[model samples]
Target: MERRNCVVTFLRVLLLVLMASVETTALYGVKLKKKEHRNAYATMMYMGTPRDYEFYVATRVLIKSLVKLQVDADLVVIASLDVPLRWVRALEEEDGAKVVRVENINNPYKGQRYFNKRFKLTLNKLYAWSLVDYERVVMLDADNLFLQKTDELFQCGQFCAVFINPCIFHTGLFVLQPSREVFKDMIHSLETGRENPDGADQGFMGVYFPDLLDQPMFHPPVNGSNLDGQYRLPMGYQMDASYYYLRLRWRVPCGPNSVITFPGALWLKPWYWWSWPVLPLGIQWHETRRQTLGYAAEMPIVIIQSIIFLGIIVMTHVARPGISKLCYRSSDKTTSLIHTALKFIAIWSILAAYLVPFAIIPRTIHPLLGWALYFLGSVALLSIAINSFLLPAIQVFVPLIGVFGSLLVMAYPWYPNGVVRALVVFGYAFCYAPIAWSSVVKVLARLHVSLEREQFLKLVESSAPSGFNKLF
Candidate 1:
């Protein structure tokens, strides 16, 4: 009994010592981390796809500009598996900067084929930031070009995040203090869809840090005009023609020989001007001269295509006046068209609406439009089957043409050939065997012949003939 008691006492003492040592080590680690964080300053950017070349250029320019302003910052650019490490390194080297390559994490929604590349890249950055000793970190999108100094971002400390006004938070530009807890929360939120179920990191952050550190976060005033009641930063900060002209004026007479021009109103952008005389010179030019020329070169092609699309609509209207009457007569078509046209008109009326107004607007609006177009296309396609028995082929095709044409109009600006390509593929499949089968079924059903019964009887009676047969 004494020996057992002695052993128990020794074990207790050993356990206490282990606990004490662990506590001391943890304390030392905390102190070291705090010290490292104080001196660390980091910035991160993501390039998920090479298609984001504009963003890439903007990021490069922003980082180079930041360095030029003498900011002691480390800019880390993250790329996916699709992006070659050598290319990324070359880009970093060109700016005399360094980039770290991170492997893409598997996302269930994105799958192994790489759907949500941006989301994966961002999560990787957050994970990396957690490992590093960073006091403050700024995350900027590759599209964001910094014309002025962004050193003020590093000054933000302790708070979960510091950024531009919530209304104008581009998500492209934000600063945060790194923490393991924050990284874990981000991953959890992404997996569970609890924080930002809609999948926006900015939205998640906004909700996560509402009462951060028991103090309301600071949202800086927009430097530009606020007449339109739209949240927009100054022109030089995030230059886009539509927003600039709307808040300011069309022919903004600012400094000497410096006039900010909104060359593209609704359907056109500044780059669309083929004539050199019409093109604005000096500061009014787009950030990249090549972009301006590319826009100009591409505009004529778009305009020509629009004319062709319009001609198709007109031909359909003339060829099948009955379908036109149905569309114009229906409450839904009239309402939808009027509503869409009015909204477009209202947006176009804003002086700067064509330029960068979209930049300030909630990102949800674009996706909403896309969804609306998809819904309308679906409904119109469904209508074709319902009206097959009631209307002629030409009439049915008329409404389909109109519905698809509208979707094409709305999407062409952003997704150039997406709608057109889909339409062509669909047309090819429709013209093949499926359409013939549908026609045969429709005709048989109209003639009071049950198609299924008729097909089965025909198969069984392959050797038999109709009319009177020799019988007993």
Candidate 2:
């Protein structure tokens, strides 16, 4: 009886252990599924200015495209206290769209310099929102227009955050799964301004999610040879007016029939009204609000002034005989011309040298400083021109003299590359040459004469004292 009891007891103990193991395994699977489901909601955030009518129109187009894709999603519009709520209200009227207006928080670091504080505030808000119910969200700048539906982004799952590579992290386009941990980390990262602060969000992710660097979830999309990132999106998406019109030629037209987002770099926007023909009529009308009335009115006036000033300078030099005689008698024309030419060469050499450092040094910080120095040198040249024209005897030789001074100063023994050093020398010379030429021309033009032999003798004879013989 005792032996039978022992066998039965052993069997019961084994059965209990097996049951507990099965229950634990089932619980683990359930927990994993629950975690996966938490990241299922599709969401996108847009921050825009209240007065931006063009941006509003673009947002509508984006919403229409998203609806057409049949993806269940929400669009959140972030606005500040200064912006009217009507903008958000107008967007929410669209079917299946929700616009949330968040008040801008005061940040001193932002806008103290040339930085835009609004963007940083919106980023902070997005970080806070991540702690809420949504599983996944996309942060898009207000100017983004969707060419096609991007619902496949959800497939990247919780482990991956989708964004464009080779771009600044703050570029305002990214896909992330919402988590309290990430939210806390992002907040800390923003507060400290450190990429990987001790226990901060972005930094923590960089360390924990090192895999992200290699398996970046979304390589920026490509369609028919078109690249699709926030910046490189098709012409139908947000086209930067600065990069398009001012910086580069616009090869494609931006219009409504095709979707285009407008990021409000107003000073840099397309000034030509004709460029809008590629857009839908309604969108064209919307974009017109972005046109600066002051800039448009001033452009013609500015062109007229420039033309008049140039004509005055040219006519003054070409029309005066007395001026030519004075120049020929007082200054050695050959030496003056040679000096002018040498000054040109010297300025050009310096400019070339300045650009060499920019090309060879990978860090932008030093190059930016170099640009500031170049700009200051240009300003000095302008000052010399004004002084030479206004005060003829001021001996406006500073620019010519400064050329060699700058070259000697920039040629440090530390930079040993001959090509780089040569470029730097050329850059300084290039920059100073224009200033020197401008000053010389201004002085010559103010003297009031063309170098003609017949007109020179007539002017000298007329100026000779009464009854005095004129010397040829």
Candidate 3:
């Protein structure tokens, strides 16, 4: 009996030891989960602007690229409360992002005269400081194109930024340790009417961190511990996209050539198809997006639009001879009012052919598809004008040819430098300006000649059915 009791006790003790070991393993796993999420790459999003969708697409691409590169950090977005639920869910479920929704920060500088609409809501970017749950946050703008994993940036000091300009640090990408104290202090500064020149986040942050330019460059510690205090980052971190236009390649000689920011014209962003060929670096960003986030959302609409535009072109060409034969009728009467009306309609039709694509092309479609559709849509609209008004094809397509020629001139790769490239573009436009102007003049003169011809074409008061306008 004594031996049996001793064996039973040994078994009970072994069972307890196994249970304790299991519990310890589970607790360690929980700790690992917390450690994995302590650092984040964050950006901000707010609604109520025309470029919201465009920026949202950019933001999605940026986060997904980081995820694709396997950065050892959580992806987060500081979206405003009004942002759509679908967008938030997409970010969470589709892209693996943690979104912190907050109220839009009031911009005290909004009432000031000459404030740019582009910077109106940028003050909301200051919310990065409020993310106290993160040990470090790399705040970013959507226009930033990461060339590689910048995970080393998380090892920098409490506040670190790159000086894209000689003296001014760019807010396009910055590293900060999230703290409630600093966030509240920023709010206090804004409420107290801080000296914000230009009334933009760049200007406000510039004034806020006036001494960052004097700080030493950031160096990640060999021991792999985070540092404290402000530090200046090398231009390599935020190499301005314009710098590439001058030398045709990245020549920034400091830090890691890890990121590029488009700080030039707002309309010439990397995502727009028209910005490509003019801005060569845009293709690189699109390539990154293509690999990580396929163009499924915008591709269907792009395909449908292309098909419709092509069909219109074919139908217009087939009916051209018939349209002229059926619609033309000799008449002896002409009036100043009638001639002027016809001339006006002819000019408007050509202008619409050139301008309508900007309205219909999907804003976030792949750049290649966008450019193709722009061309097809223009041609389709021009064909309609040609078939309807009997205008010369050369005169109708002059603007299209001129614009394409100018783009080619600007995009020519053999320019000695950007200045010479600029002059070449200017010269092309200066010479071609007259041709464009004369195209309109020639079209009006043709209208006058049509009225005096041996067989004058009948006015728009034709017997054709009203179904003619249903092509759209």
Best candidate according to lDDT: 3
Candidates sorted on lDDT, descending: 3, 2, 1
lDDT by residue for model 2 (369-408), tens: 3234333344333333332222242324455366435645
Clashes of 1: 9
Candidate 2 or 1, higher TM-score: 1
Please list the Cα RMSD from the true structure of every candidate, rounded to 1 decimal place: 18.6, 19.7, 10.3
Expressed as tens digits, the lDDT of each residue in 269-363 for candidate 1 is: 23222211122221233343332222342345444544543564455434332332242233333344564553343223221312322332222
Cα lDDT for residue 193, candidate 2: 54
Error of 1 at 121 (Å): 5.2
Off by over 4 Å in 1: 1-54, 105-128, 159-169, 212-472
Considering every candidate listed, which one attains the maximal TM-score? 3
Model 1 vs. true fold: TM: 0.38
**What order do candidates take by TM-score, descending?**
3, 1, 2
State the lDDT at 457 in candidate 3: 34
Clashes of 2: 38
Residue clash pairs of candidate 3: none
